[model samples]
Structure formats: C-alpha cells, structure tokens
Target: MSIERTPATPDPNWDRLVADLTAAPAEKPVGPVLQKTADVPVNRPDLLGDMPLTPEWVRTPAGWRTRAEVGKVNSVRAFRRWVRRQSTEHGHGAQVFRGMHRTFLWIQGTEGVQVATARREVQQAQGDYKTAKGHHGRRLIPGKEKYKRRAEMDKAFAGSVTAMSRYKAAQRDARTRRAARGALAAAAVAVPEGAGIYLIGGTGGVIATGSALLAFALIGRRTAGGELYHDHDVKFGDTLKLTDSMLNKIYRDAKVIGADEVVELLTPCTLTADGKAWEVTLDLPSGTPLKKALTAKTGVASALGVKVQQLHQAPGDREGRLQLRVSLHLPFTGKPDPGPLLDLNCINLWRAIPMGVNLRGQEVSTSWVERSGLFGGEPGAGKSAAANDLLLAAALDPTVALYLCDGKAGADLTPFEPIAAMHDTDGEPERLLEILEHIWTVEIPRRRALAKEHGSRKLTAAMAAKDPRVNLAVLLVDEWSSYGAAADRRVREEMERLLRLIVQQGRALGIITLCATQKPDADSVPSGIRDILSIRWAMRCLTPQASDTILGQGYAAAGHNAQDILKSQRGVGIYMDGEGAEPELTRGYYYDDDEVDLILGRAFELRAKAGTLPAGSVPLADQLRAVDDDDARVLAVLLDTFDAHLDGEGEPAEWLPGSVLVDALADAGTALSADSLGRLVVRTDDEKAKRPWLGSRVVGYPRSRVLITVRDRFGMGE
Candidate 1:
C-alpha cells in the first residue's frame, strides 16, 4: 500500500515569524573591500587575471560606496550547490561545468552581493594533465608513489600500452583483409554474355608489388576497331537514371544530340550489342539545345525513356558512335511532381457536392459507404426516408450487399426489405448486435491476411485483385443510440470496439457502415468512431450542440429545422466528398416501395437460382425474392393494431384483478407481471386526478378510476 502525503504543520516560531515578517531591518551604507593580495606572481598570466579580485572604491557626497554590489547572492549560491549535487549523481560533466561559468556570493558584514566568474583550473583531458596542475601545485595530484616506485609502475603501464597497440594493429589488418575480399567479390561479377568489354586506357599504369611491365594499354578509340564501351552487368529492361555529371561524360563525349527544349522524361533501354563493345548511332535533329536535344534523341531511342548517354564514345576518345544508353536526367533544382503514379488519388471535396445538398457550397457528400451515408437528425426530420433513398441507390449495384438493422423495430427500414437485406422487429437487439460484431471480426482478419499476402502497406490494387474478401459490405444501422441503450454493458463495449475498428480500416477493405441516430452527443458517438468518419450526413437537429456535434460546431446556429429539411423532400442529401467534405445539402436519389420491391424481387430470383453467392455479390433471386407470407401477416398485424389504437377505435374497457389481468395482458402480449400490474394500476389511479386522460377510464371498487385500456389501441386517442 502506498502512503499519501499531506500538508506540513504550521510554523512553530510564530512570534519570531510575525516580528521578522513585519519589521524592517536597519539599512547601512555599502563599503569598499581591502585587498589581501593584488598581485601574486604566476607563470600563467591568464590564470592570475582570472582570479576574483577587489575593485577600487569611489567617494561621493553620500559617502564611499563599492562599485560591485551583489543581489540574491544567497539564492544563487544555494542553486549552484543543488545543481552540483545533481550533476555528480547523474554523471553529466556539462551539467556541472556550465554552472561554473557564473556564480554569486554574499559579501561578509554587508547586505550586498558579489558576482564571480569561474574558469577551470585544470585541463579536462589526460594529455594536458601535467600542464593543468602546475597552477594548483603538486599537492593537488591524487596518486603519488614517490621516486623509487614510480619507475617500475611507469614501465608496467608502458608494457600494457605496447600490448594494446599490437591488439589495435591486428584489428586493422583484419579490416584490411575483409576490404580486399569485398573488392575481389565485386570484380567477379560477369558482364552479360556477348556484351564486349573495351579498355578505354587511363593515363597512369601500375603493377603488383613485384610484377614486370605489360604490353601497351588500349587507349581511346571508336567502336569500329578495338575500342568498345564495357557492358557492365546491366539487367534487361532496366532504366538507368543518370546524374548530370555522368551525362556530361557519356553524351557530351559522344556528341549525340536531340530535340525538345524541356524534357520531363522517364524510360528504359535495350542493349543492341553484346560484350563491352555495345555501340549504336542515335541520329538527332540538328541545332537542338544540347540538354533538350539529348533528352529527345537518346531518351526516345532507349527502351527506357530516360537518356543514359550524351556521347556514345568512351572517355578520352576523340570520335565515337552515338549510342543510346538507358538513364534518367533529374531536374536540376525543382520540386518533383508527384502525379497519379506516386500519390494517393485524393479527390477534391468541392466539386463532388450533390446539386442542392450544400446551398452555399459549404458541405459535400461523402463517398464513404459507396453512395449511402449516416443521417444525423432529430425526430420526424425525414431522416428515415432520406436514409432509405440513399440505400436504395446502393442497392442498384449487384456487387454490394446491404444489411440494415432497424432498431426502431421494423418501422424505419421495413420499407426497404424488398430491395435490401434487413433485420426487422423479428430480430432481437442481442442478435442484431451479434450479427454486427461477426461481420467485422471475420472481415478484419481477412483484410489483414490479404494485406500480408500482397506485401502491401494498405489495401493496394495488388491485394484487392488477389483477395475476393475485399469487397463492399454496406452495413446500415438505424437509431444506433437505441441499439446501444437496449444493449447490456458487455454488448455495448463490444459494439464500440467493433465500430471503432471498422470506421478506421473499413474504407480500405471496401466495408462501409451508415449509422443513423437521433442523438449525436459526445456520449452517444465515441471519439474513436468519430475521428475516421470525417464524412458527415446531417439532418435538422433540435439544438445547436446536437447540430455541431454532427456537422461540426455552429451547425445548429444556422437555424435548420425539420420544416426546412422536409421541404427539400426524400432522396435529397448534401454530399461532402474528398478532403474538404463539409456537409453539402444534396438531392439524394429516390425510389418508391414498389420500385424497391420490383428490384429485390429480381434479386431474389437470382439468389434462388445461384444458391448462396458471396456477401457482396447477391444472386438475382435473393435480390428479387417476394416478401414471405408470414412476414406480411406480422407486418399487417402491427400496422392494423397501431392504426386502430391511434384512431381511438378501441373503447373504454373495465379493469380486472390478478389472474384476470395476467390473462388479459398475456393475450395482448404486453407481458407485465401481476405485481408490476398492481403497481402501475396504483400509480395510474393516483396520477389520473392530476392529469386528465384523453382515452377511456375504468371506475371500479377499491382500485377506483383505473385506466384499463391504452389511450387508443391504434394510437388515435389523442
């Protein structure tokens, strides 16, 4: 267990502290210092001048005052002591050495201060050990054996020194041998077969330590006779990017020329000749600027567009063939253009905005989830229908598999069951949660495996082509806040983890999620999930905080409301694509329930014929399958019951107790317990007098004035 520290006790000497804190000390005039020794003779003039000394005093009408006055001298001295302790403990010489340059000390018998500058008395290095101590004297030296023992000790150290030198020499010889071996290995590399090696003679010649003179060396010559360019081990179809210095020797020496003043080029070359005698004439348009001309002639001639040679001749040759070698000429001093070949294909956020999505070009649609996106808004903001339309567009693609979990039961997403794979009221919140996690867990590992197999740093073309798993899976979640609210803590944590990872890596794996929620608060949308979702699709929100939470700060400040958004109609969305994807108001694509049904009917037909296709690739039968008869019946029941309740068709019903109540609730599928029913009955009666009811009331004995029926069975009571 760790002990906690608390504040220190109050001062014990209260009377002294009070007196000293309040009272002022007597002020005295500054005085001069009487020098103990002004001139001490020393061999080093530099050392003597560096020592601290007293200065002359000046006399004034106020009295004599010393020119030097110190302030905060005690504090400075304490700080210096602390710093020295730290340096000694830490073993950093500079930490202590830097402090010695300046220090302060209080003058004795005066309330004044003195500043002193210090210089090191001894040399830091061993070579100057003797010279350094001359100023301090021999007493300062640490070890002394006297005269007799010194000779033997010195000889022993000398012997050790000799042994060290031999050891160092052996190390050097070993390094030299290693270097020679490297040179021989390099020399063994063979030139490509048939590529002639020509010796372009150098001015100087040398032999081994004891070798006789050889024949006259081969000097500079044209490729026709004995002279040839040595073909080094250049592999086939390799582009040689040459430095300017090499170009001067290669092309300038050969006097080869070409056209095009500005040559921004890259290319490869093929060797026509075998052996070192590789030579060819690259004819050029005359009077072209040598730099521009050479780029056009040699660069264009070589398989690699880069120009490797200037003149085709070897060095020292008076005349030679104009052969095109493969090489690149770097721009002298300019920024390299990183075009499509090198950089990520980032889109401009400005141009991609949907036509009416951003009224002021402020927002753009995100290409995040293929075409569809998350919709953030308040209740009755047309968020549900708007989301439906976007998903409908995505459903057009056969390769895209859409899974929508409508936590509003089936209310929000049920209309799209005809076109999209949907989980409705039939799905338990727990099962929906499980399905989401399973999709991500399986997907994440598969993506990782694909990235590893292709040796790709990310989802590159190479990996995507090889891995069938990297396909689009559009996951649509309506009212995610409700999903989280209904889920247990463990389930919520799992959802958070899955969403965080999916939002981060989903873009590369072609998996996209369109998560919609009425609540867009810090607590509702986690930080990790929000960071990667720079793309936003916002609807009208109740408050400024909610709006800003969805579309950045100041969105609600603009006064958009449900009336304004609904006026825009369904299938209309603001597009925010690319980098600057601020929320753009867009007219989203729309499809009615009939159109969606027809399309999915076709898809279902394909699915039935094809059996189970991959996640993204839906079979035609699966896409176009008719809604099952059982599902239709359940949906009809919910609609009819809710409508009847809303229309006030269900009349006032009498209250029944205990067994009677349980049986009634069971038939209605309300599933309340007898105790729960009793509590609700009591509370309902108590509050009935306070708030008038719009629906039927049942007046009975003991439990009098209890509301036996819902406001309206189909919700028309109000």
Candidate 2:
C-alpha cells in the first residue's frame, strides 16, 4: 500500500556515499499520519425531524453513512492508524527501536562528514600537485641559468606529489572500512524491561512469573569484523556493549567526587575494549602511585551507580600506566549461563576446575595440584560454591584422594562420603581428631616417602599419573568456624593447628588444604594460617572490616571492596591469587545441587575406571557404629573434671551433677550439650538405645566405673 507524503530531497551523492558505511533500516512503506480525523461517532440520533434511522454508521465514498448500512469504504485516517498499530506490534520493542534508529542516524551523519572532510583535503592537495607540475618547464632567463631553474622546479614538483600521495592513502584506508562501520553502527545491548503478571490460583494464591533471560536476545561480536546481531533468544552466554562514554562517566564521576576532598586525578585517556574488559589506561598525577587513584574505586562505583564490590581496579606503579576496568551492568547479567554440569569431562586437571568469570565473561579456573587456598565471605555469599569449584576439580581427577568436612549440621559434603578417605560433618571433636590423625600419620608419611623416592622437589600431576601410589590429596573444610565451635577445647585448637601444618608442609607431598568460611575473622580462622593460604577469594562480605579480614589488613583500603556486592550477584567476588598483585573482579561459577550431582556421578565413574575408587572398604554405616567403641574421650573428660569432694564440702566426690559436666566439657573445648549428657547418663526409651552407659543414674559419671573404663582402655587409673 502507498500513502500520500512529501518526497525526501534527492541526495544521490550523499546516499551512495553512506550506503555501505551504515546499517540501513528494514524495508517498510512510508509511515502513516495520525490526524484528528481518526475520532468519529459510532451512533446517531434516532431521527432528524422524525426521519427513520438504523443502528450502524461509518465513512463511505458515496456519502456519510447513517445508522443503516456498512460498506468497504471507510475513513482513510482510521485505516492508516490500524496499519501503523500492527507494524508497531510486530517491530522491535518500541523504545529500543527508537533508540537504535537515533543511534544509527547519528552514526551515518558522522561518517558522511568524515568522508567529505577527506575528499575536500584530497582536492586541495591535487590542486597543489597540478600547480607544481605545471611550473616545472618555466623558461630560463639566460642560457647559463636554464638548467638551475629547471632543477629547482623539479624538486618542488616532487614534494607536491608526495603530499598528494599521503592524502590519497588516508582516503583509501577510510573507504576500505565500510563493512566495519556498518557493524559498529548496529551495535547495541540494552534489554527491554519485562512485565510481571500476577496469577491468582484457587485458595487465594498468587504467583508472579518472568525470566530475566527472556527479556531479550544476547547480542555481541565474537571477533573483530564479525557479524553484528543478536543470537536468537540466547538463554546463556549474554554480553553487554561497553561504550566509551560509559567508561568516561565512571572516571569523571570519581574526579567530581575527589575534587570535593582536595584530591586531584590526572585527565583520563581514551577508553579501549577487548573481549575481556573495557580498558582505560591513564597516569595518575606525578609522584602519585596508581594505587592512590585506585583507592577511590568505591567513589567511581557510586558515580557509576553500582555496588562497591562490582567495581575493580588493577593499579600499576607510579612509573607505569593505571587501568580501570568498568564492568557496569555486565556483572549483573553475565554469570554461569544455564547449561550442563561441568566436571570430569575435561582431561586436563590443571585448568579443568572452573573458578568463576572475569569482567569480560571469560572462564577463570584454578590449578590446585599443590596450592593452598582460602575462600571467605559472609553467609550466603557463594563462598561454598567457589570452594565446590576446587572440590569438583579434584573429584574429576582420578588420581586425587579426597578428604572433606562439613561443619554445619546439614549435609553438604555427605554426598561425597563414598569417595572420601575421611569425612566429617557433625563437628564431633573425637571424630575430627581421628581424621586429622589419620592424615597426619598415614597419609603424609606415605606422600613424603613417595616424594623422596623421586628426585623432584615437589610432586606434580605427571608424577601422580605415572605412579598411582603418589596421588594428590585434597583436604576441603566447608566451614572453618565449626572448628572453633567444637566442644573439646584442646581438640578445637588442634584442628586449627593441623590446618596450618597441612598448608605449610604439604606442598612438596602433593597435598592441598582448602578452607571456606563465613567468618574470616581471627576468632574463626587464625591470621597466622590465613597468610599461608596464598590464593584468596573474597566474595560478598558484610562490611569493610570483614572484607579486610578475608583479603588482607590493607586490602579494602587499597580499593578492592567486596562488601558492596548485591545479593543478586551471588557468585561474583574479588580475587587475589598471590601477594603484591591488585585484586581483580571475578565471578564464581554457580553450580546447583543437581548440576553438582552430575559431576559427582561422572567423577565416580572415572575413579572406578581407574581402579582408584574405594574397594573392599568398611561401609560408612559400620564406621558410625564403631564411633563409640572404647569411649576413651568420655573417660578422659570424666577423669579431668571429677570433683574430689561432694559439692566441694566433703572428701572428693566420685560423682557430680550432669550440669557441672556440661560446663566442664565446654570449658575443656569439648562441646557437649546437657541434653546429650542426659541421654548418656540417664536412661531413655528402651527401644531407642540399649541403656545408659554411666553407673550412676542420678546425674554424672561415677568415679569407680570411669576408673575401670580408663584402666582397661588407656592403661591409666587414679
């Protein structure tokens, strides 16, 4: 269909000039005009002067129809409005389409001006070259001076030709980038806002349904000069375009903020980009280190309208350049795209473990064959997920032996009991003590012997692959605070000491310690051991103090702020792999339970295929049954806390109240609740347990029976 419209001015030269330099709009008819004629009456008076009339009315070619007849002819404006409405319904989102149209127009205007400017300069150079060539044959004033005059004109002509050639080359280079200009003009990444539909069910239930992934298709260019378009409704692998203005805004806002505080920063350089980051390279003021400007990362972030943790700075020395990587909305959207489980499918143990992602959405992984790492953050900050990345890495490697612990009451690590050589989750001091003892006594000594046998100072994956006897051992503690929370005082301290020893001495033996905790403070994880963990990952923290506690003493002051990460940014964090390097922005891989289980299943198959899976070993249930055998820890606590006098008024009392025993146990660093003591001393349901083990039914352990048990077990008696 065609519409009456004013014709656009013919600009054949300009149109052809920009044809390849910009993305053309989709083919469509001229847009319709929305005049006031669309408004009309649908009904009319029953009669004019008592004339009969029907109920329908509309515009017609013959005349204005009354209430009686309807025909094909209708209001031209109404028909055009309907066409426009349908086009809009089928087009790209209204706001996005408009924004794209404006951006494309702007690009076209700028490119055309650039071409014209080059052409005009070339024309001027061509005129100069012609003048120089024409003057080369000027007549000589005398027979002797003829050759000298001709030589001077020849040199001038040569200079003009060179100038003209340079101008022509520049114009040619611009003409060659027509397709790149088209791609650049079409680049865009803003997602349309989604709508929330509340659905009410029976029993007055309501639910809102929508997916951020469904808001729009992901758009990007995989390589330079590649196609520029959206991947049709991509669910995973989303990326955002980082523009120069967006980067400049971050730096400008930081300066505006710092200027108020008497801090002056150097002018920013041009912003550049690659697949990984939008890089801004500039120098700080003379004599001022880049670290000084980097310290205002939070200031820049607030100006950019993001949480502090979402911004990261990679500072250089005073003599070098400073780089500010602005993530903007990238971290908010770029994360583990929905997909299959990542696991033992990768053969390279060195790079197979997925840590998280860098600012550019690149995969960041760890090679933990002989490294010690500590992961820390507040509760629900994805600390466990980061730890799981390493665990999943080790699990996929058939030559790695696993030792896992979950200090919480829940069973996050229980799923791996089948593969682990030793595992604990209940925080039973005795159980953990034995597990540590086994590693310290049997595991370390064997690894040391294997290391000494080989001439290499450290055991590598190649060595482990060659010799099955010298496999890698991974010790992963899910919760560090649980150790300090143990009921047994000495056992609690011993657990901390053992973690330090493993990280300090286990490097050459191919043993690594990975401790994850919500509390990275000294009370939970001692500073002495924390420094030993070279690879530190600080996820979302609650405050600056907590952020500093996890990264280092001066980490937060240096501008790596993890406390500002939003809750929605679950698996994102700041990472420092070694000392003396600035922390970089990173996102941890987010693998759910089902995804983790998939890797677990594959790991089991790999272990079984390699003949490394546990075979002919005692069942886990059997191990639980043997936990109470001998009961040496109970006997020792009884002997230590025994009262010599009844209520301290008579000769030493052989038996004391259960309450006293509970307090004494806690003081001794052995956490035992009063209710648990009741179950042990006072008999409960006969169907539940055999009977109370203590001889005295009133409250605490009897001194006589305790002496007998101790004498029989440890050969010690009072």
Clashes of each: 80, 15
lDDT of 1 at 229: 33
| Cα lDDT of model 2 by residue, 380-410, tens digit | 8888778777777777787788888777655
* Candidate 1 residue-wise lDDT, 246-293, digit = tens: 333333333443222222211112211111112223332344333443
Which 10-residue window of candidate 2 scores lowest in summed lDDT?
29-38
Give me the runs in candidate 1 sitting further than 4 Å from their true place: 1-366, 369-373, 415-427, 460-469, 555-575, 605-718
